[model samples]
Target chain A: MKEIYLDNNATTKVDEAVFEEMRPYFCELYGNPSSMHFFGGQVQGKVTEARGRVATLLGASPEEIVFTACGTESDNAAIRSALEVFPERRHVITSRVEHPAVLTQCRNLTQRGYRVTEIGVDGTGRLDMEELQAAVDDDTAIVSLMWANNETGVIFPVEEAAALAKSKGALFHSDAVQAVGKLPINMADSRIDMLSLSGHKLHAPKGIGVLYLRKGTPFRPFLVGGHQERSRRAGTENAAAIIALGKACELAGQHMDAENTTVKALRDRLQDALMRIIPHARINGGGAERLPNTTSIAFEFVEGEAILMLLSELGICASSGSACTSGSLEPSHVLRAMGVPFTCAHGSIRFSLSRYTTEAEIETVIREMPPIITRLRQMSPFGREFLKEQS
Target chain B: MWDYTPIVKDHFLNPRNVGDIPDADAVGEVGSLACGDALKLYLKLDESKDKIVDAKFQTFGCASAIASSSALTEMVKGKNLDEALAISNQDIADFLGGLPEEKMHCSVMGQEALEVAIAKYRGHEAPVHSHDHDHGPAYPDQEGTVVCKCFGITDVFLKKVIETNRLTTPEQVTHFTKAGGGCGGCIPKIKELIDEVMGARPEEPRKRPEKLSNMKKMQLIQEVLERDVRPLLWADGGDLELIDIDGSKVQVAFRKACAGCASSGNTARMVEIKLRDLVAEDIVVEEVPA
Candidate 1:
């Protein structure tokens, strides 16, 4: 079956070029970067080169980039370090629509005796900037926010939020896992003190990420042990994946605009088709300035799981509801925060296209989705009565 | 996605009966589209014989909805009025193997429509009693706390679920009674009740090296996790210890990853399946965080 993968927000396929660049390091150049030997020195060179590449992508100095295991680890490191650096500062402000990597960590911090103020987002999934400003106080340690929402692809004014945090004498950290490759993010002009990015969200392999900590930030190490990452992160370097990340970052810098244009067109086409063909269908994350490649639609009378299963049968891979999360009982917190009705929450489908997504695939989904939705809705007692009620 | 049984999937894809009767003797509709699911049933009654002649339905919602409608139609067709009324969600699920308990209400909706339609055939209003048995309080309980939003089951209903379905795990309670199935807030409650119910049952002496099939082994694992393992983890702010069986030993892990966790042995005692718990004596429970 010709599988059409549309769950880019969850994770992405490794680019062939990135994979090829990484293959040699895993085998021939498999040396511990920390070792004093020449074999290791060569690996260290590659790590330095990878760091430079990742730094270049964000317009940051190579010395400031600290590679970690993943975005979650980077986030944990940033939040934990911020809290430790300013223990007396009990107040922390953040938006409600952050990924669990930030949300759970904040919640954990709250339980550990810190007063964390979570600001809610508007119906369009935009943060309340005024409310955010009101929440931040002189005692605030940090204002941690995400660059782009993983679920809705909604972008936040990271620079503006960072400036607000800075004005309040607090540091700012943005989880840029979803934004680094897709959007134009410049670390130099931005007031962001710390930013997290994952390689998997780009074309690189998993288990490798970069955290850009501004040169003069009051940061402490979350992982303690090795002198790796300049004593910032303590772990042996994932030399191969890091090398792949560098290549992925280089490629992202070049193809970013072209991919955005192509993917946006495809996304718009898919969204238009779904709205036209399916009754009571609307984009859940509409009216927000979202990433060009993503679209989330709610099929009013159908279950999200059923829609996904049908799509799967046709080799069309996608995600839906809270069902997308393994064993999770709650729907997407981002959607819920935006006040998406529960009636449509469990029935929302996110179609996240990539740079590789084709017009043919978009056309196919447009053709297939309407019928799949219609069939599921037909099976729905809710849809039947809804139509009855309408009539 | 909810782990739907193959039978449920099959029944959903190739539903037994669908579409509305052109001239139905009676029609029944329940639930609203606003509620996220609805069912409309049409029936042709052979009044002289006091039996159902033809049945069909139009459903709006998930796979379970369509399957339930189809199953209801099959259950009623060619059956006497009393026999049709006697058909329960369990019967429909049994007819189609089994359905995920969260989806058991889908079948229950069919049963509800059937009752309403039968009452309509009798030329009387099917009094909208609060007790919508298929997903409502199946067991009489004056004081049991209500759990399972999808099914509205209680502690007594859970006990009946344990006894009737021979449910030995939290998953089974969820499947049978729809408890601990939605939002999963009541999973611990379901697990607790399973232990209490099993404790109430007379203990059978341990069977030595009993040859068990894969299905039996899965049942054991489910029971062990629900009755024995889940509650311990629940108390610790954690849950699912393992996904399924791996070779001989029952593979287990932690739900939310245990706080200050260094050992997996504490989680082993939580498994309810007697066989797996007994097997734990010989086999080591390996805990790996994924």
Candidate 2:
């Protein structure tokens, strides 16, 4: 079976070019970038070039990018550094829809006597700016929010949010793990003090991430030991993955136009066809500005895991916000925080496309999805009643 | 990702019976859209109304849930009401080779629907339809106080699952019945219920061996503490570390929530009782301040 991989937000395939760029680092060019020898000096030059590429993608200086293990580490470093930098400030603010990388860390801060406020989102998964504005006060050390929601694909007004945090003299951070490659981001033009991005979310291999700290932001190290990463992060450089990520970011910059146009058209066509063919369904973040490559559809009267399993049979990969899929007894916090009703919350499926997603793949999903919904609905008691009423 | 057995996949992909019997002799429904899974089981009995001649199901849930429902309908087709009533959740899981531990609640839902169907047919109680969505008990006809408000599960329902499955921890209860899986506010209550159910079981007295090396006795005590006692404490966010053992007396120190608790004495006594029953009749548990 030819796999139609659409779960890109979860992770993306490593581009072949990016893989080839990193291949030599493992064998022939395997030298510690920090070693004193000339062999190492040559590796260091490539690493510097990679850093420049990544910096160009984000409109940041090479000095601002500190590579870490993954997005979670970058997020932890960003928020914990802000808290350490402003120890007297005892409050943190975030949104209910933030990825767990930020949300869980902010929540854990509460146990250490820090007040954490999670601003809610509206029905369309749009961040409640008013709630955020009220939550940001003099005592707030930092306000960490996501640039885009992973499940709903809803884009937040993060630059405006950073401005709100700045007015209160609070440091601002954004977990741009989902938005960095999908959307255009220029740190030089923004008030976001710290931003985190994962390599794997942008078609690089895993195990590499970047924390962009604005040049003049007061900061502290989350991991402190070696002089690696200018002592901001203390670990041996993940040179190969870093080089791969740099190449991926450069490619992402080149593909940004097609990502916004071609990929967006594919996402829109898939969303529109599913909505038209399948009754009793709604797009989760339809009213909000969303990432061009993502769509979350909620099919009523059926569970998401069941839909996903049937889709899996056809080698069509996707993801869900359903409780059962995640091994939890409650629907996703993202949907719940958005005030999505229980009826649809338990049945939301997320389809995230990438540059690799072909037009035929989208068409195949459109053809196979409705019958799967129809089959599951026919087997559902609530769906049966609804079908009866419709007939 | 679930490690679903091949049989489970077979059943999920090609479910045995997947519709309704409009003239069903009894209709049993459990769970709701809010709960993330639901099953509407319909049974058609023979002319004598003793044996189930036909069984069909309509389910709204994940793969394991649909497979369990389909397995239940197939298993109950030729069985009489009493025979069907004898089927446990484990029996349903075993029919499908086995379901993942986290997916056990799907099997429990199947068993509950079967019991509800038979109970309704026998006029034991009124049928509670899930479509009402009142957030009331999933099995309102079965009597008990509502313990897990999130899933509308009652103490009666919980105790039955715990006792039948021999479940010791709150996590198992959640996996089996979805109680204490949401918000987790009722977790302490669930721990208490587990204690009550496990305590109600009859303990058989074991004849103590006449002679044992001191090392062996100490090892036995530690094994019992690790296997039997710590889980119960861990469920309540508390734990005990064995400090030392001198002959029959075991010195222990409470940790976490158990430390400095006013009820530490009662907890110590309970530990002593457990050690006495499981190891030796004269074992003593002494709590030392942490």
Candidate 3:
């Protein structure tokens, strides 16, 4: 059966070009980038080239890009470094809809004498700018927020939020893991003090991430071991994945226009078709500016896992914010923060598309999802009640 | 994703006796939208109302919750009312092989709804006790000192689970009862309840230092509040205030978001424990009604 993978925000399939770019490093170019021999020296030059390519994608200088294990590590390094630099500042501001990478780190900070102000979102999953404004006090060490929410696909005004943080004398960091390739980001023009992006989200392999520190930001190393990444993130570099990321970044730059055009249109086609076919299904972040190739649709009175299970049998893949779907006791925090009704929250499904996402796959989803929802709704008690109410 | 047993997946996919019985003799419902799961069970009873002749359920929850409800309806169909009441959450889970540790509440919901249906049939009504077995004759006025705020688990319930299951440790309590699973703010309280139940050490005169200096006393109170109470309150967008201490009576206040919460008294008592553990035994925390 043909497979349809629509959960790109969770992680994407690595591009074949990027994979081929990384193949040699695991075998022939196995020498360390820090080594003195010719084989190793050549690898070091390629690694530096990779850094330049990644930097180019983010509109940053190569010197400012610090490579870490993954996006979580980058987020950790940024938040921890901000705190280490400004020990006297105990307040940290972040939106309530951040991915666990930033949210969990901010939560951990609260236990260590840091006060966190999680700015709530509006009904459409848009951040309340005024609330975020009031949260960024002078005592705030940093304001960390996501560029785009992973669950809702809602885009945050990171530039405006970063500027607001800067005005309050607080460092600003954006976990741009989901937004890096799907959305246009020029760290050079923005007030973002630090920005994080993962390789995996941009069709690169996992195990590599970049923390772009706008030059002259307060510096502290979370992993203080080797002189790698200019001692900013200390460890032996993930040579292969870093090379893959470089290649992926280049491909992402080429596909960036396609993301807003073909990919966006494909997503829209799939969304509109699904919504048209399935009555009472609404988009979670449809009212706000969202990622071009992503849509989170909620089919009321139905559980997401059941829909996903039925979809899986038909070679369609997606994910849900439902408590049962996430293996958690509550629905997605993004949905809860947006005050999504319990009926919709329990059935929220995020369909994230990437360059690899084909119209055929989307068509497959459009064809397969309605029946799944109908089947699950037939089984759902709320669905029955809804039908009763309709009648 | 939860590694649900095949039986559970089977029950979830092809649930038995689904839909409502509108003209049913009795109905039992439990859980809510806010709690992320709910179940409505309808039972058709024999003329004697002593035997459950047929059963059906309508559930809004995850796969396991739906499956658990479906499994429950199937399990209790042929049994008498009393035998059905004897069926526990574990039985519902056991019927479906087993549920994930986190998904056990779904099973608990099934059992509570069954009890409620039985109660409805018997001409006595009570608020849904799906959260735990703390309601009814189990505790006077269906009231128990709530220890785990995340799952609405009461101290009475914890003690009962421990006594019945011979459980030790908060982790075991979470596994068997799901008390301190979410947020984990109630874990220290869960530990204390376990300690209280096991008779490991008396609440008073077990861990307090013999004599603490005035400097040490002040430092301890501040540290405990800062280290423990403040973070917990702050997590929920609330702030705590230490106003005045007169002898052993510590006057505390909740500020910002948590000011007028009904649970402020319970929160104050939690603060009182911190004060008692750190400084002295007879430290009473009176919330200054702010």
Best by DockQ: 2
lDDT (0-100) at residue B41 of candidate 2? 95
Q: Give the TM-score of candidate 1.
A: 0.77
Candidate closer to the true structure by TM-score (higher is better), 1 or 3: 3
For all the models shown, what interface RMSD does each have?
A: 4.0, 0.6, 2.1
The Cα local distance difference test for each model comes to: 0.76, 0.90, 0.81
- lDDT for model 2 comes to 0.90
Q: All candidates' TM-scores?
A: 0.77, 0.87, 0.81
Assess the local accuracy of residue B54 in candidate 1 as a C-alpha lDDT between 0 and 100: 89
Which digits, one per residue and each the tens of the lDDT, describe model 2 over residues A1-391?
9899999999999999999999999999999999999988888888898899999999999999999999999999989988988989999999998888899998899899999999999999999999998889999999999999999899999999999999999999999999988899998899999999999999999999999999999989888889998889998888899899989999999999999999999999999999999999999989999999999999999999999999999999999999999899999999999888889988899999999999999999999999999999999999999999999
Give a tens-digit lDDT track for model 3, residues A47-138.
99999999888988999889888999999889999999999999999888988889998998878888999999999989999998877888
True contacts kept of 2: 0.87
- The CAPRI category of model 1 is acceptable
Fnat per predicted structure, each in turn: 0.49, 0.87, 0.53
What order do candidates take by lDDT, descending?
2, 3, 1
Off by over 4 Å in 2: B126-136, B200-290
- Sliding window of 10 residues with minimal summed lDDT for model 2 chain B: B127-136
Name the better of 1 and 2 by TM-score. Answer: 2
- Highest lDDT among the candidates is held by which one? 2
DockQ of each: 0.25, 0.64, 0.31
